[model samples]
Target: MKLLTHNMLTSKCLKGVNVGYPLGIVAKDVKVLETEFNSEFVSRIIPKLDWDTLWNAADSIGHAGDLPRAVCDDYENDVEFLKKVHHVLVEVEVIEGELVCPESGRKFSINKGIPNMLLNEDEL
Candidate 1:
């Protein structure tokens, strides 16, 4: 799964959890695939992203060097910064990993670039 997808995921569906957003990533395999950069697309997505969560997730997988702690005010005109954001948001892929819910500690396995987010009956 792409970091972009991971940024939007949450584990709030689990029982007794208030806010299950920003699920923790434990990546065992990571791949960086080349993607064509679109500054407009990156700029559009910046507003929707949770910057801190994205930064932490990228850091967890050892890829946060280029990401800023917060989205800068002048990001739209910053090509270099946008390129870094684009790389993290689109190019980085998690091949194998587990997404751990912060509140419940439930783990969702990711394999072959797919994250299995289905909860067991008891979990629901």
Candidate 2:
């Protein structure tokens, strides 16, 4: 999964969980897939992105120093920033791992880049 998606995901569904955001990345297998950069897509998605959460997830996956706070500030006319965002959001795909929620300790496993967010009956 992209770090962008990971950033938005949280354990808010978990009962009484606190600070469940920025799910801990456990990339048992990771792959960097090349994808065409689309400025419009990046610009559109920027508004929905959480800066802090995206930064934390990128840092966890060893893609730090690319994204800057100002990227969001001047997202309208920043090609470099958009490229970086595109890379973090589209290129880096986590092939396998489990994203654990910090607050509830819920484990969401990812296989072939698909996260299994289904919880057991009790967790539900």
Choose the strongest candidate by lDDT. 1
- Can you write out model 2's per-residue Cα lDDT over 4-110, one digit (the tens) per residue? 77877887777677667778898888788989898999899888888777777777878765678545567769898889888888788888999998877778999
Error of 2 at 12 (Å): 2.0
Ten-residue stretch with the least lDDT total in model 2 = 64-73
The collision pairs in model 1 are none
Runs off by more than 4 Å, candidate 1? none
Could you give the C-alpha RMSD of every candidate to the true structure, in order shown?
0.8, 1.7
State in Å the error of residue 87, model 2.
0.4
For candidate 1, the TM-score is: 0.97
Per-residue lDDT for 66-112 in model 1, tens only?
68888888999999999999999889999999999999898999999
Q: Using alpha carbons, what is the TM-score of model 2?
A: 0.88
Pairs that clash in candidate 2: none
At residue 20, give the lDDT of candidate 2: 79
